[model samples]
Structure formats: C-alpha cells, structure tokens
Target chain A: MRRRRKGSVVTEILTWVVVVIAILWVLFPFYWTVITSFKKPADVFRLSSIPWLQFTPTLSNWQTEFTQRGPEILRGITNSIIIAVFASLIAVALGTLAGYGLARYKYVKWRNQSMAFWFLSQRFLPPAATVIPFFLLMKSLGLLDTRVALILVNTTFAMPFAVLIMKDMFRELPVELEEAALVDGCSRWEAFLRIALPLAAPALVATVIICFSFAWNEFLFALVLTYKKATPMTIIIAGTEHTQGVQFWYVSTRLLLAILPPTLLALTVQRYIVRGLTMGAVKG
Target chain B: MRRRLREKGNAFVIPAIFWVLTFTIFPLVYSFRVSLSKVLYGKLVGFAGASNYLRMFGDYRFWGTLRFTLVLVLISVCATTAIGLGLAIVFNRKMKGLRAFRSILTMPLFTAPVALGYLGVMMFYEENGPINVLLKYLGMGKVPWLSHPLWATLAICLVDIWQWTPFAFIILLAGLQSISDEIYEAAVIDTSSGWAVFRHITLPLLSPVLGTVIMLRMVDAFKAFDIPFSLTSGGPGTATRTLTFYIYTQGLRNFDLGYASAMAYFLLAITMIIGLLFFRRYRELYE
Candidate 1:
C-alpha cells in the first residue's frame, strides 16, 4: 500500500499547488500593478529582474503624481464622492417608499411590472448606449460639468436597484405593523418613516453601499459627461499622460488615496456586504 | 385607505419616472429620430430612411470591432465562470481562513475599472512593464504588449478576469452554500463516487444559479467598453476595437451620430434577445 499512499499524497500536493497557482494568476494584475507602481521605469521594464521582494523603491513617482497633479485628482475624487453619495441617498429615499407601497398594497398590477421594468431598464444598456442621450440631456440642463449632473444621472440609474432590494425587505416584514401604524393618527408617510424605514435598515444600508459604489466606480459617464467640472478620479487616471510606464509610485499611492476612503467606508459597513452579495444571488 | 396608498405610490414614483422620462426614455427616442436624419451644417437636415443601417452593413471597422468584441466576451465569460466555479468548490469545503481569503479575492471587484485599466497598461507595456521584466528574469525574451493587437486584447481580458471573476464566485458560492447538507449525506451513504455525486446532484441543482451567472457575465463582458477604451483605445490598427468601442468612436468621438445610433440599436437588440432568453429560463428561479 506504499504506492497508494504515495498517490494520494501526490494528489493532495497537486491540489494545493493548483490552488496557489490559480490564486496567483487571479491576483497577478493587482499584485503586478502594486509592485510596479513602486519601481522606477528602468527596473520596472528590465530584461533581468526579480519580482517584488528586491527592488530600489522610489518616491519620485508619488511626489510628482500627487504634488503636481493633486488638485485635479482631488476634484475628481470629490466629484465622485458627491455624485455617488448624494445620488444614492436620493435613490434610497424614493425607492424605500415605492418598495413599501408595493409590498404592503400588493394588488396594483402596475407596481410589480414597473419595478421589474425599471430594474431591467436601469441596467440593460451599457452606459455606452445612454452616454449619447445622457450627454445631450446634461448639456441641455447646463449641468454637464457640475457634480449635480452626476447626481441626477446616477440617481436615474440607481433608483430601480434600490427599489428592488427595499421591496424584498419590505415583503419579508409582517403587514400588521404597517396596518397598526396606519390605524393610529400617523399618515402613511408617518407610518413609513416611523415604522417601515427602521425595519428595512439593513436592506437600505446595502442599497446605499451598492449604489454609491456604482457611482464611485463608474467610468464612462464621468469620462464623457464631465470633462472638467465633474470628472472623477477614474477619468483622470485614464488620461494617457497622467498614467504611463512603471515609474508609478505616485500613481498607486494616489490610487490608494482614491481607493482608501471607499475601502474604509466599505469595510466599516461590511456587515451589509452580505446584502450586497445576496442581492445579486437571488433575483428580486 | 387604498386610495391613499395609490396616491402615496404616485408620490414616490412620479419623481423617478419624471427623471427617466426627461433623461433616459426621451433621449432614446430623440436619438433614434436624429439617427434617421442627415447632418447638414452641423445640424440634422434630412431623413435618411435605413441609410444609417445600410452604412453599417458595409462598414468594415464596425464588423471587425464587433467580431473582436464577441471573441473577448465569449472567452472572458467562459474563463471567469469556469475558474469561479472551481474556486467556489474549493472554498466551499471546510477550510481554514476561507472568510479572509474571500474578502481578499473580492477586493479587485471594488477597484474602479478606469484605475484598473491604467494599472494594466503600467503592468503590461513592453519596455517598463513588469511582465517582460519577470519574463527576462526567468530567461525569457520580452514581447511587445500595447503595440500589438493580440497582446492588447489579452491584457484587457486579464484585467477583466481580475476585476470581475469575484462576482461569478460570489454568486456560485452562494448557490453552493444554499444546497442542504442532507443531499450530500445521502450521496455519501450510497457509496457514490464524489464525481458522480457532483455530476448528478450538485451540477443539476446549481444549474439555475450557474445559468444566471454565466448569462450575466456574458452580457457584461459583451458590453465591456472602459477597459478596452482606456487601455487600447481600440488601437493597433483597430485590432481590439469592440462593437461598443466602435459606437463610441462613431458617435461621441468622431461625431458620426447616424451610424453610431444604428450600431447602438443593433447592440441593444442583440443583448435584448440574449437577455430575454436567460430571463425567461430563470424566471422560475426568482419567483
């Protein structure tokens, strides 16, 4: 049975090796980006070099990137934050009410259909399709370069998703609370504010995180819609002159800058990441 | 009471519908009309009447870009789904540090796509990018990255795989976790081979989730624009030009609105057909 033991041992070793390789392959780009960002152009592209552990790290890239390009990047970051946060708040506010109305009332034929329609329509077009009309509409409003433009556009896209999740949460809440609240002097709005909204807190938290991230990470709209005033960090990074070669200590540091706030916010609310995960897991 | 409810419903949705009507649906129809019009003095002049559609028929760039997009989408979708499924299974087993590992794996999904695109260029460009450096360190020769069509596509695809495979993993793992423990115990008692049990039980049961994830990723990959747009800009003689990229080129960048509209409409039509097919198949899964 020595050969049998050998075979199983080999199998186990092979599995571990495969897993390690796969994980490396998955992380190659990010790891490579992080590593290269610390290296000078010469070391970054050398014909003979080790990966990661040994290198003459440089702060030159970061110094140039943030010191010279700081304000531009900051504007974009601010725009992204403003757009993502405010838009999601607006979306959550409207969606929460709509969700409860549908969940509680139930008989309206239009409610389910409209919600589904909005959900599908909100996401169906790659921002590519809408970019044109969205641009035109933004131009008409003279809101093109303002963070307000992003807020409006992002809210349009975010509302349906926010509504879908909130509806699901509301559906799970027993109807008696709402009925009792309504029976009291509380208007439907008061009942909604006083009762349902609190109950749906978890879903709302998830909705806000998800929507905010979509706005924050959004590339196309920011690229096209806001050339100057509302440009996000994503667009600034996309600029060819700003992003080049391996002398990128500054880029990744700046990248870390833009990434950190959202990352911290995300980690802080990571409890809701389950809602984020499960949202896409089950259909609304 | 119900009437009050109806009024409440109207109150919440009216603002949202107004936003969509003003921005989204309105512009969609308006753009269609303009697509049918001819540009005269930087303004729409005449109704083209399928001329825009006909123009796309002969546009080699549009077709070439479309073919490239299909290849990118097909490969990325299959690759992400296969790798994601494998990872999900591995992590599904009782394991050490799975939670922490999962959080790490998902970090890329949170990185903005535009930053990821720039990250790709810095990491893959021939002279200073680290891939070639590592290659040479291992005694391999350096290869040009951005200057060539094939490597550019590969680079973009790698970035997507890094950024998005977590999405597939999350969905599939959720599916796997939802399967009850009893089913596995039954299979174990039957003395069934693990592979057979997986093929017969796990695979079939996971089909709905698997199907949805695949369809979602495929559509997502198909419509992918930012990575290819930012990294390659459909460069190296239009080798990496995707259909969506072509739309941006023709419409926004080049100001060829008529042709771009036709291309956009065609993309919408294709995605709708595929999306509807998946939506119908999985309707039961949701309801």
Candidate 2:
C-alpha cells in the first residue's frame, strides 16, 4: 500500500512538471514578444540578455510604429478589420443556411455526404494553387487591390469551413423546438429565424470568430491580391523590416498589434476553438 | 410535402454552393488550363501541353525542395503529434489549476504562423537570444540555428512544433475527456499495471482521434509556407524552400505562371490524396 501511494505521488509530481513545461513553452514566446515590443531599440538587440528584465522599458517602438509607420500600419489594421469582418459576416450568413439545410433535411442518397465532403475539403485546397486563378479573375474584374476582392476571396475560403462547423452546431441542437414552433402555425422560415437561430447563437459566434481569424491571418491571398490598397495586417507585419537590420522593436510592435484580436477572441471562445478548428469534427 | 421540403432545402443551400463553387471549382479549372499552357506576364502565350509538368519533373531543385518539404513534414508532424499526445495524457489526469494551465497552453494556436515565424527569429537568434542564453548558462556553446541548412530546418521545425502542438493537444484532450470514467475503472481492475491498461484500452480508444489529428497535421505540414517564408525566406541558398515556397517563387516572383500552376497542381494532387485517405477513414469512424 505504501509503495502504491508513493508511486501515485511520483506520478502526480511528474504530471505537474509536464504541465508546467507545456504552459511555459506556449506562453514564453508571446511574453517575449510583448516585452520586446516595450523595450527601446538599442535594448532590443543587446548582446546576451534576458527579456522582460534588465532592460529599460520604453514606448518608443510603439511611438515610432504609430508615428513613423503609422499610416501604413493603421491602413493595414483598418484593411484587416474591414476584410475580416465582412468576410466573416458573408461566410456566417451563407454558411448557417447551408448548415441548416444539411442538418435538418434529407436529400437524395449520398448527396448530403458528398456536399459535406466538398465543403470540408476546401480546407485542404492549397491557397498557393488557387491564388493565381484568383489573381487573374480579380484582375479581369478590375477588383485587384480593393477590399471587395479580399472580402470576396476570403469569403470563398472561409464559407466551406464555416458551413461544416455550423452543420455540426445545428446537428447538436434538438429538433423539438422547431417542430413545436411549426405545429403552432409558424412557417419553417419563421420557425428557423425565431427558434433555431436564437439557440444556435453561440455556435454562430464561434463560427464568426473562426472565420474572422482565418481571413485576418490569411497571407498568400492578401499578398497576391492586394499590393497596396488592401494589404492586411499580416502583410504589413511580414513587411516590417529596415535596411539597417531586423528592427526587432518595430517588428515586435507590429506582431503585438497583429495578434491581439485573434488571441483575445480565441481566449474568450476557448471552449469552441477545438470545434471550430477541426471543422466541428471533435466537439470541445 | 417532401417535394416542398426538398425545394426549401435546395433554396437554403444553393446560394452558398454557388458562392464556394465559383471560388473552388472555377479556380481549379482555370489553374488546370494555365498549367497546360505557357503563361507569360499573366497571359496564356502558347500551348505547352505536358511541357510545364515535364520541366518541373526534370528540375533538380523541384525534386530537392520536394524532398526537403517531405522531410520537414515528417519531422514536424511526428514531433507535434508525440508532444501533443504526451501533454494531453499528462493533463488528462485530474489536477489542480488544470483549467488555467490549459488556457495558457492554447494561446499559440491563436497567434498567426507568420507572427510565430517572426517570434521564432527573436527566440532562436544565435547571439543574445533566449535559447542560446539558457544553453550558455548550462555551459554549452551556441549553435547556429537559422544560418545553416540542417540547423535552419531544425529551427523551423521547432517553431512549427511550438505553434501546432497545442492544436493537436486540444483535439486529443477533447478525445481523452470524452472517455467514460467507467472504462478506466474496468481496465484498472483488469490490469494491475497502469501501462498495461493504457496500452490495451486507452490507446485503442484514442487511436481514431490520434489518426485524424495526425492526418490534419500532416496535410498542413505538407503545405507549410508562412514559417519558412517569414523566418528564413527559404534561406542559405534555397536550403529551406519547401514545395509551397517554391511554387510561390515560381508563380509570383519568376513570372513563370504556367510552371508554377503545374507545381501547384502537383501539390494539390498530394493534398487531395491525403484528404481522400482521411475522408475514407473519417467515413469509417462515423458510418
């Protein structure tokens, strides 16, 4: 009995050790980025140093990023916001209806299955493969370098994943409410809008956040589609370099700004992240 | 009544289908068209037939970069899966502060890969960086991380593992948490050793999720671009350029749209094959 208890105690200690390591490994880079953003430019590249300590904190990087590179950075941020929000809205709006259709209705044999596969498989389509065609198509439409082009392309990529997620969301919801609403002389559309939509609100929020993050972080499409007019935050962050050197401080500021929205949204919707990420394959 | 219901369902679905199809299906055909021709300055200049593909197959850099990408995918996917599973298993046990611990652990998935790439630059810096600093404290010499070929690959892999392990962990943890306590209780009684119970029961039950997670990671790893693109820029003389980066440079930089489209199609084929395999396994799991 004593040996067994000792064994468990060892296991317990080991478990906590592993957990601590995982947490530190995950958070350290983010913490480092945050601190590096606050440090002065000289302090950033100081030889043989620790982050978050032994360095004078200054807002100079932020000041410079805002003042010197302000227009471009702000433009990137604005573009990112506009694109992510519109793309997410478009994806969510279209995806919810498709999801409901897939969830509640039976189509011809294998039809639903094939449609779901088509939707889910969009995630597998290499953006590299699709970018050239999108570029040419957008150019033909005379929409290159416009936010609308980004919005449309982002929607295309985001909608399929959004559909699958909302499908799963709708699948989990019981049909009794909608049935009763229909029985009470409500049309199917009205029942859907009044009853099902309200219940699926949380899942909708999760879908929106996921779509928003995907659009915001998308790089290659943004890179190829928009040269100047709609260059999003990711491009701006990637383009942050000076002739002198790495410009660690300025880059850190850009990194911090770029990651803030997705990080906050992911944390708030932590419960739904696995669901959204896996396209609702494994429910969180 | 069924006909009306079907009509309604089609109504609800057709609009989205049209939207996604325009992007995916049209691009696929357009890409294939471009792949079969010579695209010069964004125009189809001549009929290349299989020449673009023939050229790609013959190019030594294409084969070399592909081999490099496959190697990186194998290393990173395996590392991420192993680490993710290990962390999940450890955290699966009931413990103090588990919720808070998990919340912190998942932040990396939220951060963009490009951001992580930049962060990797700072963290993996040869001089005055944290990793080297810690190594120096341990009486070890600094290793050239991103400057050398093999070291650059390893550096990129480390960053990939750091960013993606949480994604795997989250999926596996959800898988783990879904297992009933009763199953473990029964297994514990049947086997005197913990390892025996795990090897026989826990692993078998978890294999499905593990397989799915591995396939997902593999697909993403195969198409890895942002990390190498931002971190090394496929640096040290094309040593770190993966297939996607290669394609990007060919299409975007070199203006060889036809050749780039062919390469991208080749990549798409690889991704599709994996996706099909995954779909088969996923169908088995579900149906």
Candidate 3:
C-alpha cells in the first residue's frame, strides 16, 4: 500500500509538470505579444527584459494603431472581410452541390472517382506555383489590386476544402430521410434543398468557418495578386518593419488586432475544427 | 425520378467542376507552356525548348535550396509530430482546466503566420528578449537565434513547429479519443506495463494518424515561404532560403519567368509525388 501510494504521488507530479510546461510553451509568445503591445516604443526596445508588470505600460501603440495607421488597418480589415465572405459564400455554394453530387449519385466514364481525385489533388498544389499565372492573368484583365481578383482565387482555393468536408458530411447522413422525402412527391432538387441541406447544417457551419478561416489567412496569393488597393492585414503586418528596425510595439499591436477575430471565431467552433481539418479522416 | 435526378446532379456538379478547371487545370497547362519558353523583361520572347529546365538542373543555388528544404521539412515535421503527440497524450486524460488549456494551446495555430513571424522576432530578440533573458539568468551565453546561418534555419524551423504543432495535436488527440477504452482495460487486466501498453496497442492503432499527420506537415513545410519571408526575409544571407523562397526571387525579382516556371514545375512535381504517395496510403487506410 505504501509503495502504490508513493508511485501514484510521483506520477501525479510528473503529469502536472508536463501540463504546465506544455501550456507555457504554447501560450508565452501570445502573452508576450500582448504585454509588448502595451509597452512604450522606447521601452519595447530596452534591454531591461520586463517580464510582466515590472515596466510602465503605455497606450501610445494603440493610439497610433487607431489614429495614424487607422485608415490602412481598417482598409485591410475591410478587404479581408469582403474577400473572405465572398470566397466562403461562393465556395460553399458550389462545393455543396458538387459534394452532394459526388456523395450520392454515380457517374459514367471514370466520372465520380476521377472527379473526386482531381479536386483533391489541387489542394496539394502549392500557392507559389500558381502565382505567376494568376499575376499575369489578373494584370491582363486590369484586375490587379482589386478585391475581385482575390475573391475569385480564394473561391477556387476554398472549393476543394469545402467539397471534401461536405462530401464526408453528406456521406455520413443516412439516405433514408432523403429517400422518404423523394417518395412523398418531391423532386430530386426539392428533396435536396428541403431535406439534405437542413440535415447537414452542423457540417455546413463547420465548413463555412473553415473556408472563411483559410481565406483570411491566405498570404502568398494576396501578396502577389494585390498591391496598394487590396492590401489585407497580412500584407500590412509583413510590411510593418521600417527604415529603422522592427518597432515591436507597433507590430505587436497590429498582430493582436489581426489575429483576434479569427481566434474568437475559431474558438466558438473548436469542436468542429478537428473534424473539419482532418477532413473527417478521424472522427472528433 | 432516378433519370431526372442524375441529370440534375450532373448539372449541379458541372459548374463547380468548370470553375476548378478554369482556375486550377488551365493554369497548369499554361504554366507548362510558359516553362518551355524564355521570358525577357516580363515578356515571353521565344520557346527555349527545355533550356530553362536544363539551366535549373545545373544551378548550384537550386541544389542548395533543395537540400535546405529537405532538412527543414524533416526537422519541422518530426518535431511538430513528436511534440504534438506528447501533448495529446498528456491531455488525453481527464484533468482540471484541460478545456481552457487546450483552447489556449490552439491560439498559435489560428494566428497568421505573418503575425507569428513578427512575434518570433520579439521572442528571440538578442538584448532583452524573454528567451535571452532567461538564458542569462540561467548562466548561459546568448545565442544568435536569427543572425547566424545555422541559427536562422533553426529559428525558421522552430517558428514553423510552434505554429503547426497545435495542428498535429488536434489530429492526434482525435485519433487517441477514437480508440475504445476496452483496449486499455484489457491491457490492464493482462498486467501490461505502461510502456508495453503503449508499444503493443497504442502505437499500432495510432500509426495511420501519425503517418497522415507527418505527411501533411511534410507537404506543408516543404513549401514553407511566409515565415521565412516575414521573419528573416530568407536571411542575413541566403541561409534560410527554401525552394519556395528561391522560386519567388527568381520569378518576381529577376523576372526570369521561364527559369522560374521550370523550377516551379519541378517543385510541383516533387510535392505532387509526395502528396500522391501519402494520399494513396490515406485512401488505403480509410477506403
């Protein structure tokens, strides 16, 4: 009894140690960003390593972010929201129908399997490879630095993801409900619109969040495809380093602002993220 | 009803398929054609007929970047998977405050890589950064986390690991949770040691998820550009330039579209090969 108790006590200490270290490793950078954001510009560059509340906190960084750089940051936010929203909406709409088709109906002449693999394969194509073509195409169309260019590219980018998630979601739902709806004098379109769409609402939410999150985070295309007009938060953050060195105060403030909305949105849908990310490969 | 449904389904799918074809499929063909032609001053001057491919194959910088890319991918993928799996195992049990910890743990994954790069600069700053301060307090010399060549590569990989490890954790945790509790109970009844329980049962059951996670991280890390672009700008020198960054310089900066296209296509081939191999394995495991 004495040995068992001793072993259990030792294991308990080990578990707590690991948990604390893991949490600190994951969170300290974010914590530091917040504190550094509140630091005065001079204090931000000081050699005094203020660990937390040891130094005087200033609101100058927030002041600059809101006042001087306000329009640029707000423009970035607006561009990101518009692109992400349109991209997710279009991707979801097209992907839902195609995903439903792929999940439910059989195809002819190497149709279903080929189409599915083709869509999946594009997800593997790196963004860098497609940038040149996109740049030239957008330039020729006089669409460079336009939100429309990003919206269109982001739609295709999000489509494969949406399709994969929706396909899995549709596949898991039993066909009986839809079949019953079909038997009750409903057309296939009506059955799908009224029955399958409502049944897949949870996955739809997951898909929407995933699509929006990805479109928001996308950088390379946004970088290559736009210049001054459609500069997203990502580009603005990347360009924050000035003729001097990095102003940690300014950068941290912008970084915090840039990440907050997506983080909050993601947290609300945390459960679905695991499933949506793995593309239903592992059940959450 | 069945005939009409099939027709409607075809109609439903055609538009989506067409959109993908226009954006993805057509660009691929166009890129291939551009790869075979020489571009001077942003204009395709003439068809070079494999000269660009030949030049890329002979370029030492391309080879160096290729080597760096492989090393980066190996280190980042291995580190992320190992650390993530460790955290997943630790968090697998019921514990107080686990939910909040898990949520906070995922914060890095959601943050933009650009933001993370700026944050990395502060975290590793030489004079007053938290990491260096801790090092000094511990009686150690400050390491140049981003200035030196080796350390720059290491810094980039560390940042990648920091951002992506949470992703691996979520996937692995889901995998762990899917295992039936009866398996562990049976092993306990057999008086299995902790290591034996993990080695004999947990390892095999987790292999598929582990493989998938590594493959996903490898493919993603193989194409890493943003962190290095924002953090080190591919270096104090070219110490941290991966294949993607190299391609960006050649294509955008130099305007050598033909050569850059060749390199891009080569990268596409390599990534596609890895992607297809793992995809085949993934299909086998699931289908």
Error of 2 at B37 (Å): 0.4
Q: Give the per-residue lDDT of model 2 (tens digit) for A1-284.
A: 11144378888888888887777777788888888888877776674246445876788888877888899998999999999999999999999999988888777754778888888888788888898888889989999999999999889988998888888888788888888898899998998899989999998997899889888888878878888978999998888753436778788889998888988787777878887778866778
Q: Which stretches of candidate 2 lie over 4 Å from their true place?
A: A1-6, A47-53, A242-244, B1-5, B284-287
Candidate 2 clashing pairs, residues 3+ apart or interchain: none
- Give the interface RMSD of each candidate: 4.9, 3.1, 3.6
As a TM-score, model 2 comes out at 0.96
**Candidate 3 per-residue C-alpha lDDT over A1-284 given as tens digits, one digit per residue, 9 for 90 to 100:** 11123377676667779888988898788788888888877777664445555678788789978999899999999999999999999999999998888888877754676777777777678877888888788888999999999999999998987887787788888888889988999988898899999999978887887788888888888888887999888888877874337788888888887777777778767777776666555677
Q: What's model 3's TM-score?
A: 0.95
Candidate 2 C-alpha error for residue A46, in Å? 2.5
Judge candidate 3 against the unseen true structure and give its global Cα lDDT, from 0 to 1: 0.82
Off by over 4 Å in 3: A1-9, A47-52, B1-7, B284-287
Over the stretch B112-206, how does candidate 2's per-residue lDDT look in tens digits?
88878888888988988888888888998988998999999999999999889998998999998888888877777777787787789889999
The model with the greater DockQ, 2 or 3, is 2
Instruction: Kindly report the docking quality category of candidate 2.
Output: medium
Which residue pairs collide, candidate 1? A61-A250, A62-A250
lDDT of 2 at A222: 85
Give the Cα lDDT of each candidate.
0.71, 0.85, 0.82
Candidate 2 residue-wise lDDT at A72: 93
